[model samples]
Target: MKSSLRLLSALGLSLCITTLSAKELTVYTYSSFTSSWGPGPQLKTLFEAQCDCTLNYVSSDDGVSLLNRLRLEGASTRADVVLGLDDALMEQTRALGLVQPHQLELSNWPLNPDLAWTDTDFIPFDYGYFAFIYDAHKIETPVDSLEALLNSDASIIYQDPRTSTPGQGLMLWMQKVYGDDVQQAWQRLARNTVTVTKGWSEAYGMFLQGEADYVLSYTTSPAYHVVAEESDQYQAALFTEGHVAQIELAAVTAPSQNVELAQAFLSFLLSEDAQTVIPTTNWMLPVRTDIELPEVFLQTQPQRIGFSPEETEAGRETWLRTWRNAVSR
Candidate 1:
């Protein structure tokens, strides 16, 4: 009886250890990333198969909201990894000191040369250029340039600069195009502006419902329509003023207990298997160049023009103020 009791206790302790070792890695990201249609489901399965851990995603409204959520939760956040922050948010997120280095040697990965990635803390997974998407059937003569769009009375919808990356991209684009006259440009664009949404999904959905002639979104937005719906009605209006790029990044949270697992997920993100899932599901260009893309993905490359990550951080507050004051009018 004594021997049997001791053996049972040993088995119970072993079971506890096994349960503890089978960990769960929680990643904080945007809602779209974890949606059924997004890469989250497939990525969760892929990562779990190798790591022997459950991959969990906690989502906010959008990228900017991801930063806001971190600020609210700070060190108390349960996130082992934070993903979906764009390059523009890098400086702000880093200043919080809530994220640790990924510690992976990316020299072997086939990162895009155009990215010129040198940051050690944040890892870029995907990128896209901001553009105004319009239905080709409705708008036969779409505005050819930002100046033309602003100069015309064509109704438009865009995301809020404070809450959405694409809206921030448009803010940077306006500043790049109009220079010191950006205030007047915003005031001008406000004339025909249908509404400013808190997130990209709302604005894009409104556009799809024919609420506006054009909607501010990624250049790759139409790729989803072409590939999934077998329709090419949606199109990005290329601007002669050039477009700003949003590079989505992921990093290991400093407060996480699962540092090894977080880093593993980040490493897996750059792998061919993961990169293959990003383009169609996320509707963005993969960081790796080796992935073969659909014809629509190949066609949307526009002239890239925007502030560097440092420049964006420096002027962000001032630009936000300018946008708020102008749009209020």
Candidate 2:
């Protein structure tokens, strides 16, 4: 039965691959996900092998721009699918009615509070807790918590909340940890911020270039150094206040000519074959529990403080204003 469906899916899954090719599916995505080094390249190869379709990716600067690009294009977009939008922006994406609803099946999903994402329009593929990463060789004393980050004098690089998801996660983390004093907290953090870039790729690159002592990144970051580069000199600081959880997702655009095929692709994203590549390629946790991770990831993944749709919608303006006012000075 499985082999037969696999064969049929390839024949039927072709949406919009290229010019004059009807069996193609165009996906709008963030650069990192589609970069030759990122999951996008492997994803296209693997999915196409099964779907008999050409998978083309039109990448934006980052996830925020990924959505903004869609909003800017409105209904005329040729993209049948979107990958790399996060739980943070789902409220805006859903409110804008930018995507059609989907009910994709899952494997290794659970009934846990942390895994509960109720939106039918967007499907969660993977999740990770946001953290500040540092070079063990550079900083003898790594700051752990939100308060620790602000109070310490160590130089850091982070993304702009208006442009990057991890930067926005840090903003929300500060708000969640320091509710009424969010403004005061950002004021203090701004003192330590050496530079703020427009996207994750830039910020992480700056850190790699030794622009700062640390950079805002995922807990799974060190796993790359440990597993890929055969180095153990990097680490994610253990925080007193748990880190903010970011669930990365994919969705079918409302204007798509093919619904079931798009939905099938979303399902393919969560399957073991795809999830297996996500941890190393995308540098985040796989949504499936049974998938084994590099022991480094298991050793370093932080505790999560999850958010709801309501909380995300209610907090965007206040968080952005607080971050902007503190740093603009």
Candidate 3:
């Protein structure tokens, strides 16, 4: 009878270990999640509960840096999945062959059916328009357009595109607006500049701390200031030319050993619950059309602007060179 009891106990322990092992998955993303208000922990908890897999996050301060790391790690990368890459870096990600096609079960997703990538190389999770966030109290006539920023007296803060994703978005925004004459646009913008930071957090933090009157950030930036920071002074400007919209995407890494689990996580990210959480925490508009936006978002709807990823990829180097020249001049 004692021998039988020992065998049962061993079997139970084995099952527990197997369960624990099956309940873990690794994800890599941008480092915005380290904050209390960030979406990392909440997403992890929800995904784990639904999929029975624990999410292990590895994050970096910039999306480009994260992609670079994935390239460096190659097939031996510890991450099963990667998130937070925007359309700007899609070419680099694809060229590096860092990610593989994920056939997610996305029946309930309310994405723009025409806009969704047919190849399934990456799935867009959330998106928002890039704009300048400024203190309303400081400036009497706030810069209302991209051109206004170039012509404004108020100091401007922005991130360096080579090192930051928002910076890339802003650069791409200029390219979209200025087109072939982008060099001239940068020349004009450089004249009214304060200085560039390394990332969005630094630029936005400095703006909030009164270091600059205006900082380049997302349209939803003011949402956080209004709701969480409770600062009525901050507001995101609406550019007459329209702001550049960046779509954040997630994908299963090519090296992932557990492709099915990674695909399940990707599908979950597009679900209604996850989409609902995106606007509040990540300060991004949901890609899932069915998700009801918060009251704050309803009041400040971001203007939609379009740009070709191919155009951005082709012109990025030239644009940056022109911007550098403009800044130096």
Best TM-score among the predictions, by candidate number: 1
Q: Please write out the lDDT profile of model 2 over residues 124-179, one tens digit for every residue.
A: 87888888889998778888687887888889899988888888888888888888
Rank by lDDT, highest first. 1, 2, 3
Query: Model 2: how far is 235 from its true place, Å?
Result: 0.7
Residues 1-329, candidate 1: write the lDDT tens digits: 22332332323212211323438999999988999999999988887776677888999888898889988898899999999999999998898897888776666577999999879899999999999999999889888889999999899999987888888889999998888999999999999999999998899899999999999999999999999999999999998878988999999998989876677677778878889999999999999888999999999789999898899999999999999999997
The C-alpha stretches of model 2 lying farther than 4 A from their native spots are 1-22, 107-113
Better of 1 and 3 by lDDT: 1
Error of 2 at 143 (Å): 1.1
Q: What would the per-residue lDDT of candidate 3 be over residues 1-329, giving only the tens digit for each residue?
A: 22332332323212211222345678889888545678887888777766666779998887877877888899899999899888888877887789997765344456856456554688888887788887788776787777777776778889988778899888888877777887788877776677888888888888778888788888887787777777777778888877777888899999888776676677767766677788889988888667877576767665667567776777778888877876777
lDDT of 1 at 155: 96
The lDDT for every candidate, in the order shown, is 0.86, 0.80, 0.76
TM-score of each: 0.93, 0.91, 0.87
> Deviation in angstroms for 172 in model 1?
1.0
In model 2, the Cα lDDT at residue 188 comes to: 90
Question: Candidate 3 has which clashing residue pairs, if any?
Answer: 23-54
Task: Give stretches of model 1 more than 4 Å off.
Answer: 1-22
Off by over 4 Å in 3: 1-22, 105-107, 112-119
